[model samples]
Target: MAIGPSAVERWLDLSTEELRAQVKQLVAARLPGDHSVWQAIRRHPALVPRIRGVLSGLAASAAGSKDEAMQKVWISKARSALDQEYVAPVKAARKPVVKEEPVPEPEPVIELKEPEPQQKQPHKAIPTMLFQEPS
Candidate 1:
């Protein structure tokens, strides 16, 4: 029988151990976002680490799976949940940098310019063929 969103509570209703197993199987079937579990996960994000564990196991299994690319998609989905579905981890606040006056840039040490062309001069060879007599 096809399960609907309204029926999700029935699926989710189980003992703690049973629920974990069911959630594992559900995540294995598809992305957590594709199911109502995402809503529950949003409500109780402590489940993220467990989900991540399952995803990591899935990633390892993907190595031997014929559809490795598809398995990578699951990994992407897991990362997306961590990045987008929840608040980011707290980062250490950076200390304010002391303001220092800007120093003027220094002039270049070397300058380059195109070489000037030299004027053509007549060569003093063979007296410029002057007084050309019989060869």
Candidate 2:
């Protein structure tokens, strides 16, 4: 059967590259946005490469139903993304410390208190424990 106008129109509306780009963008956006989907996609051993291939192929294709479906999926993803507010985590502001007022200097009072000289004590020899009797 020949391709219908609606199908042709949809395909004409979005090129294969455009569709692929849409899918890639959607995946990128959703990967970070949705934890579950991202985890699932990441946890899947085979899905990762297959998904990459599919998305890359979708992006590279010039015309196909897959591309059209991806375009719609991208549109839905875009809509959901638009509805949410993208707020970055707020950082704490640093506060400037206030300087304290300087106090007046006090008058110098001289007090003579002589320190006693220290007496030298006799040195004692330390006892050593020799393992080999000091050969």
Candidate 3:
């Protein structure tokens, strides 16, 4: 696309003095949060543009580095640090309470006996008398 007169005017209108002032204001507005970098970024609209600029600069720096291996290492470390900062701590589980059932005791056994005595029978002798008759 051609740089039309209007586009040129728009570009010229962006004052260098104003840009510098905005950048300074951004640096002052920036603050850190306990959870994440974005948490801080989302709170301050003035700092958001500045932070994006810094991140873009970092990416450009990484891309420009002579050693691709070193650039990858730096990127990996940055990602791991960001991940560790926002992760919440895990809580321990509590032990469950168990109810015990009560068992009933067994009843005692009773023994029965007869106390009455049995009567004994007495013996009796029978006598027979026999007489001879004369013819």
Q: For model 1, how does the per-residue alpha-carbon lDDT over 6-109 read when each residue is reduced to its tens digit?
A: 43445434555554455445545665563454554544555556556656766776787788987687677755755556443479999999999999999879
Between candidates 1 and 3, which one is better according to TM-score?
1
lDDT of each: 0.60, 0.49, 0.44
Shift of residue 68 alpha carbon in model 1, Å: 1.1
Residue 113's lDDT in candidate 3: 81
Q: Write the per-residue lDDT of candidate 2 for residues 25-82, one digit (tens) a residue.
A: 5454544434444333444344344445545464445256646766556544534533
Number of the top-ranking candidate, with TM-score as the measure: 1
> When superposed on Cα atoms, how far off is each prediction in RMSD?
12.3, 13.9, 28.4
Model 3 scores worst on lDDT over the 10 consecutive residues at 1-10
Residue 3 miss distance in model 3 (angstroms) = 48
Compared with the true structure, what per-residue lDDT tens digits does model 3 show for residues 1-135?
A: 122223322322345554334333333334223434434334444544543454444556558568655545544443333333333446988979889788887887877788668776676666778887986
Deviating ranges (above 4 Å) for candidate 1: 1-25, 28-35, 86-135
Candidate with the larger TM-score of 2 and 3: 2
